[model samples]
Target: MRDKAKGDGTVKPKVYIAEPVPTFVENYLSEHCDYEKWEQNEKVPRDVLLEKIQDKDGLLNFGSAINEELLEAAPNLKVVSNISVGYDNFDLQAMAKHNVIGTNTPYVLDDTVADLVFALMLSAGRRVCELDSYVKNGEWNAEIGKEHFGLDVHHSTIGIIGMGRIGEAVAKRAKFGFDMDVLYYNRRRKEEAEQKFDATYCDLQTLLKQSDFIVLLTPLTDETYHLIGEKEFSFMKETAIFINASRGKTVDEEALIDALTEKKIFAAGIDTFTQEPIQKDNPLLSLQNVVTLPHIGSATLKTRQQMAMTAAENLVAALQGKTPPNIVRG
Candidate 1:
């Protein structure tokens, strides 16, 4: 499709949206530029994206790999606006080499995701889902015993890895709502967090050993991929409850399976995973001590709409030769 010329004789850029966006975003795009959107529930096929992007000036992408090959295919592409906080799906170096600016929606879903993290922690720690299954399975004839009792959340020590925005939000809840002792390990000590939550800065080993709950909130990177493996699990208390709301590659999934099977940790609440749409045969599904979700950390309706709008604004800004608010600078 050709760029639509406005009454001012300026050509509006052609944008390709890789996934369906909210109606408001669609309206904005239609009014600002000539655009084509993928309306399927599933991801746009790699072939389809490559073909459609051949003449696009910008791409509104989500969960699609943007690399040298894709960039080379879209010779006129100048910007890629991702509808997610993490751009691990993108190759930053390649984008830079191709002179393609990248943007992501950040901070919009922080509180919503933090809320889900806590929900996972509480559900797993209390065996809420397991007991719900038991009751529904007609196995609640007898009164529950101490053997089936759940762990306590209040007054417990929680160690958080990667004390970023979402992590800090989790800390606030842990400190204010549950009276938890929050210990955090980050690249550097955050004095503000210390003052606000009375959080203690601790080494990973110490945190693992002392904490009743361990929450992984780190981003996935070369230094952090498989950061939590066998050795790290060994450092945890046998009664420790592990929670992973971070990237899947950050944890060694097999090692985690072993830890659970060997009873190294009490239980785990996992959102992200090594593979998305985790296979039905995945062992975690069969384990009673595990609570797994389909990576719905930021799935709230309002948050999703906000993210789509933010992403649309970023794409529009970049296409209009203005700096987007959330540009991913290397």
Candidate 2:
């Protein structure tokens, strides 16, 4: 580690970037402060983070948990800026207790993630992966039978669990492109969404039972952990398609497994998982009706550049004794 004091005779704010981001973001950090960065391909091990953070005033983090244990190890830490929209990994209360601020990149990746959610919905409903496998497995010698038929997406009803920015984007696509009816359930009604897309607002149970497609887009919070469980699955129509582009813990994995195995719903397209890089033996992988993806909702090159830039700006602002633009409150 270099000396904490700079040539200007002032202590340079030491910043530790947990993961490698865009090159432009790295350049910005290097110009502004004394910064240490982890390699792009792998996360910094927890032990290294604990040791390095002791002298850091700011942290640029991606996907690592920020809690009391981490905060206790970093007495000088003043801010944590996450390069993603979701901040469920942050323990806000712990940060507040330590007088540290939290910030996240939002609005930049909404359209990119919305596009992925719509793609997942279409693929799951149409059995795109299954049939591709069927052809590659040499089962295409004869015309496919009625048993291989998939469901229609256009003119169907889609119930969105959260009416946030990305949810509104998905609703717009469903309404404009697919001519589908949009139903949404949120704690508070989205009047503009209803006015813009002719979307209907309803209770959770009503949305679950009536829609032909169900998409979960709620953020992860105490109130929303395992929001969809066994009873929630029972509410869906037997032919409905389920899509989750939100946090994995929002849905109970075991219940989802049972729902798919028993044919409670037609199929599910999942982007997030309770455990990332989902376990090898996870039952969802063995199910024919489930389409699973690594959590790549915000993985587009352009959007990621924007997110990294935003996070860098946030970290710089906080370390300079200014309030971060996208600060997250406890």
TM-score of every candidate relative to the true structure: 0.98, 0.97
221-328 in candidate 1: lDDT tens per residue?
899999899999999999999999999999999999999999999999999999998989989989999999988888988998899999999999998889999999
In model 2, the clashing pairs are none
- After the best TM-score superposition of candidate 1, give how far the Cα of residue 105 lies from its true spot, in angstroms: 0.9
Name the candidate that leads on TM-score: 1
> Please, what are the lDDT tens digits per residue for candidate 2 over residues 155-177?
99999999999999999999999
By summed lDDT, the worst window of 10 consecutive residues in model 1 runs over: 1-10
Model 2 scores worst on lDDT over the 10 consecutive residues at 2-11
Q: Provide the lDDT at 181 for model 2.
A: 97
Each model's Cα RMSD: 0.9, 1.3
Clashing pairs in 1: none
